[model samples]
Target: MTAAAIGASFRPNELEVRPDGSGNLLGSLCRSCGAHFFPIREACAGCLSEDLKTVRFATEGTLYTYTIVRQSTPAFEVPYALGYVDLPEGVRIMGQITGVEFSDISIGMPMVLVLEPFGTSEAGDALTGYRFRPADVTSD
Candidate 1:
């Protein structure tokens, strides 16, 4: 891993990382129907219009559902909380849950996007990814 690889976004197309350590999740906003989609779409799903634009999604959302995975591939550690959060833009995003006990998490709880070290690359370079945390919880 090279020094430049540190703090790099795991998926640059979906996430934008700033030099000041602030970042946002990228998505597409449909100009015709006022809809938003993750992974940035080329056309509007709601109105079937090609008039769409890239936009930064809101960081806050509501917890929709979750589960704790006890087993997975070697790249991921077991017993991590995974959940879908419904953002204000009307998109549900899947991400890991952190900063709170698994038992304490509940549906409808407010969550906020948090950027952290996701994992290493094939070359052992550090990568930045995102997780959802309880909105009331402050970072250390």
Candidate 2:
């Protein structure tokens, strides 16, 4: 299968699933200015660097801020937590917070990245996406 074929049904970025069926999301790291971007970028926003290397991000981060989305959107489910995560590599990402109740969410909480089904593309293929879950639940 082609890269588009596999990534078509999943997230915006190409994902690699290990033999254990664990997902590892891929992103681009700017080789020139050391900037990292999720969903990948053709050029670095900091230095306008065109040389980017693909990298797999660590599946852990710290919650920066969040909001309990009570209203449903076309692409997201209602009562979900959406927030920015401060990755260890110094890049901040906006994503959903899963595996926890909305009442339990707070700033500076520990989180782990996980792949989830977001919605669909324009062509109607299921679009898998990434989210951050409370680290406490996966700490065992």
Q: Rate the local accuracy (lDDT) of all candidates.
A: 0.91, 0.76
Clashes counted in candidate 1 amount to 0
Tell me the tens digit of each residue's lDDT in model 2 across 1-140.
Answer: 33343333254365654433356667889999898887678999989989999898888889999998889867555777889998887778888888987888899999998765556778877555567899988622
lDDT of 1 by residue, 25-60 (tens): 999999898999998999887889999999999999
Of the candidates shown, which would achieve the greatest TM-score relative to the real structure?
Answer: 1
Q: How does candidate 1 score on lDDT?
A: 0.91
Kindly give the stretch of ten consecutive residues in candidate 1 with the minimal lDDT sum. 1-10
List clashing residue pairs in candidate 2: 10-128
Model 2: residues >4 Å from true position, as ranges?
Answer: 1-9, 12-19, 120-127
